[model samples]
Target: MEAAPTPTLLLAPMEGLLDFVLRDVLTRVGGVDRCVCEFIRVTGSLLPDKVFYRFIPELRNGSRTLAGVPVRAQLLGSDPSSMADNAARLAELGAEGIDLNFGCPARTVNRHGGGAAMLREPERIAAVVAAVRRAVPAHLPVSAKMRLGYDDPGSAMQCALAMQDGGACEVVVHARTKADGYRPPAYWERIAPLRQALRVPVVANGEIWNLQDAQRCRALSGGDALMLGRGMVADPGLALAIRAADAGGQGEEAPVEVRWQALAPQLARFWHLVCKDLDPPQRAGRLKQWLNLLRRRHPQAQAAFDQVRVMTDQRAITLWLQQLVAAAATADGQAPADPAA
Candidate 1:
């Protein structure tokens, strides 16, 4: 039998959670093949280039993160004509790719008749996708993401088929109904039939927090591609670890440890960028938000979170992080890169 091809690992486009700032820092850690920017809500307007740039700053840098990973812009809306018009502009702006978001389960998004609400109307899904596909150049890749269904897994295959029929080159199934709402057990098996039937690639996503989950997701979904979300945020080394295990061949591979010593610099760099780019009020919260998630996988992050939990001042947080980075560098026998620098 011919050998199976290597899997393509993508970073999931988490709204508010995984914006360009985190995307830049995480991609810098390496192993991610591509990233999808957070969903740009298209209402009825053509949405100026600034709107696209505001959401996906990478468009200014050749549609790629500073680390050079291509970032695809995602659009969420119910209006097929508006979606098609915006997609055409994104294409003209030189987006690396376009991804339609039909999987967002936020109440605000759903209340607007966008996101997973569209899953309730498969014909609408097909019309929007076909419209966007027609608007973009033939060489540009158009993709779509969706849950198993609005409330159950009943329409999973129908929605997947709709995406394929609408000219999406690839489709990513999050493996749970929107009603499941980021719950445990992502129903990886549900993706198997969709993978088998779809002509385009099917990428499995959801609840893959560790190497074991990645292995099992691939085994059950029977697909090579996977999209990482909170898992990657909680453990920045996840994608690289998954890649290492993949290359190591058929056995239980040891977990790849991402030491605090290594992560200290990334923390420092994230802070630097946050201070540089974001407003004063938003800066401190961003670091704490990341540490809150980081504490899921790293005990050290719990301590770090405790120290900065009440800090609203960016200067105070900067001082605390500098000390943390310096301490880590000392233990690792290296000179620290100043956190403020």
Candidate 2:
């Protein structure tokens, strides 16, 4: 009997939020197949190699995170020539793949005729994808991330077909229009027809927060692959939990879900990375930002957030994290971890 293929789980590129640091922590925790780096906004001139390295330090580590998951460098721009040029440079820099950004809803991006603004022009979308495809090596996959449409889903199919016509190997559709904007009740159902219409694989994104949501998303989107963003951020073990649930349903033992105790080490690891890599002024806020999101899934995170919410001193925050890690490790019956490490 033939075994089913493993579902492809991709960590989404969230500009300003899910950079290489968080990507490293999440991928290390396990079960993500690939990650797309935050979009590198390419304009008229060719960007320096340092720019790519800055956004995706993994590029220096063979375009993979420290955990060794392949990272695809994403490019966002309106000019096909410039996008193609920059993508060629990314390929030369040994990028595993190149992903286009057509889904960013930022007004600044839209005003510049980048991101979701391209959804309004299917022809332009096709051109940008085609140009980038032509520039990069054929073996290197070129993909795109897009919203359903600019304001509504009326042009969704046309835009998707444009991407296909332009030779994108895969397309990830965030199931909402630009107007919808990160609200509850993601229109997972809208992805079904796009999946049906596209020849290449269509991965569904948006609002998948847990196992039940993953199941419902698969059922509604009619696709096995998923791209996770904020949902995965809120719960670091979401991908593993989904995979375990899937395996358990197929008569395998389901491992215990990752609890806050297990997550303490990862949080400590995150703080270590933040302190080591980021600037001093940014360190405290970065920790607080993650705790703010983490509080959504774990009550322990709420306590942690409360403890650090008023703190701006890096040394003070570090001390708090060290204590937190030690307490969590003790609760789990293990030796305390070096939070500074």
Best by TM-score: 2
Q: Please, what is the TM-score per model?
A: 0.95, 0.96
lDDT of 1 by residue, 1-341 (tens): 98778789999998778999899989988889999999999999899888899899999899999989999999999999999999999999999989999999999999999999999988999999999999999999999999999997989888999999999999999999999999898999999999999999999999998888998999999987999999999989888888887888443322334676788988999999888878888888889999999998888999899989988887788888888889988988899976444
C-alpha lDDT of all candidate models, in order? 0.91, 0.90
Error at 134, model 2, angstroms:
0.9
- Kindly list the per-residue Cα lDDT of model 2 for residues 1-341, writing each as its tens digit: 99888999999988778999999999988889999999999887799999999999998999999999999999999999999999999999999999999999999999999999999999999999999999999999999999999998989999999999999999999999998888888888999999999999999999998777888999999988999999889888888877887666542222344688877878888888998899998888888888899887888899889889999987887777778878888888899866444
Clashes of 1: 0
Which run of 10 residues does model 1 get worst, by summed lDDT? 249-258
Top-scoring candidate (lDDT):
1
Output the TM-score of candidate 2.
Answer: 0.96
Residue 295 in model 2: lDDT: 86
Residue 107 in candidate 2 has what lDDT? Answer: 95
